[model samples]
Target: MAESGAPTQRESMADRIYQALKEDIFEFRLIPGDKFSESDIAQRLSASRTPVREALYRLEREGYVDVLFRSGWQIRQLDFKQIEELYDLRITLERAAMHKICRLDKPPPALRLLNDIWNPDAPSERAFGSTVRALDESFHCELVAAADNDEMTQVHQRITDRLRIVRRLDFTRPDRIDATYREHAEILQALIANNPGEAAEKMTAHIRTSQEAVKGISLERIREVSQQHRRREPGRP
Candidate 1:
């Protein structure tokens, strides 16, 4: 009960189910093109079919899932054309935000989080993983937010939300993780120096490299793991 005796609101089960499914997909547990029925999700999550169906419908609307027959759902595939478009859009928006950011007399408060992330002894220090990538996504979003433009931040968020499934895979290799950290540090240095031109260049390079890295890892892992799963089937010839 609240201090004023007003009841607190409860989160809907459908929302929970939607986030659970999204997390699984974003982490690659539910790989691209993997299919399952409504019953399958309901049983696995220990939730009723109604909420699962509701969640699937919401995910479908967001381009994360698609309806296959009457009750089947499949995780959407990440292809080169789609990724290229996403990265292109990302570059345009982010570069604009970086320009706006450099015009400011001071950096946004979000820089504190970025500083902590880069520091190993800091509380926010995360190695290469989905968590780190989620932070990376947030960093870009904060960049836009720091521009203080509402609409731009919203659009950047939508793109980043869907791109998470593929973007985080760039850190699969230790070398890639090291490269990301160094590049991020360099980008930060440029931003701190109030050099929009240099920051824009560095940001472009960092994002493009990550785009290429994600393409290789996500595509190859999907193909490699899918083949392994297929071969393990009892009837495989």
Candidate 2:
């Protein structure tokens, strides 16, 4: 039911809050398990509580945050199990994309776009990581487009969106960023050579190695955060 004077579909406010929160979370400005208050966000953004609440609801639905019983909202923590699932899903979709890329006689524009962003001469780790992340996303998207599977692409995109925060965290580590670029080069070479099997293998290995490297972070830290958020009441000291 439309409100007496409200528009049927409001576009911008929810999106503004979404983008703002997403950037903060991805850049680690909002640490995992950090508590958030709807009132605080609403005040800071100079928006009504309704839109801020809407944004928080959407974030929670997307697995980026969890709504505690009495507490406000908490950023979701990363876990090995979720990381493993992300890699497994990527392997499946990426292999399909590799096959499609190899079958084509000429490279698609998407592949070219990926190559441009992944240039090896990038100066800073932050810039390099940003490029790599973009390229990584473009590669998978190109694969889906090449396969001409809209439904699967949507599904993959949804999963990727859920993993964005963790992926950003993984890439921010200096050593991981370097290793990621090296792996990207190898993967690109395999794609250029039209070796679907080799490309898939390299992609899978890259994801696995990255996951293994970050496995050392204490899951206890994540658990502690989750517990704290769960216990804290909204507006409490």
Candidate 2 Cα errors over 4 Å, as ranges: 1-11, 104-106, 113-146, 169-182, 219-237
lDDT of 2 at 66: 90
Tell me the lDDT of candidate 1: 0.77
Give me the candidate number with maximum TM-score. 1
Clashes of each: 0, 0
What C-alpha lDDT does candidate 2 achieve relative to the native structure?
Answer: 0.71
* lDDT accuracy of residue 212 in candidate 2: 70
In terms of lDDT, the best-performing candidate is 1
* TM-scores for the candidates: 0.77, 0.70
Mind giving the per-residue lDDT tens digits that candidate 2 earns over 4-32? 46565655897889878876665455667
Query: Which ten contiguous residues of candidate 2 have the minimum total lDDT?
Result: 228-237
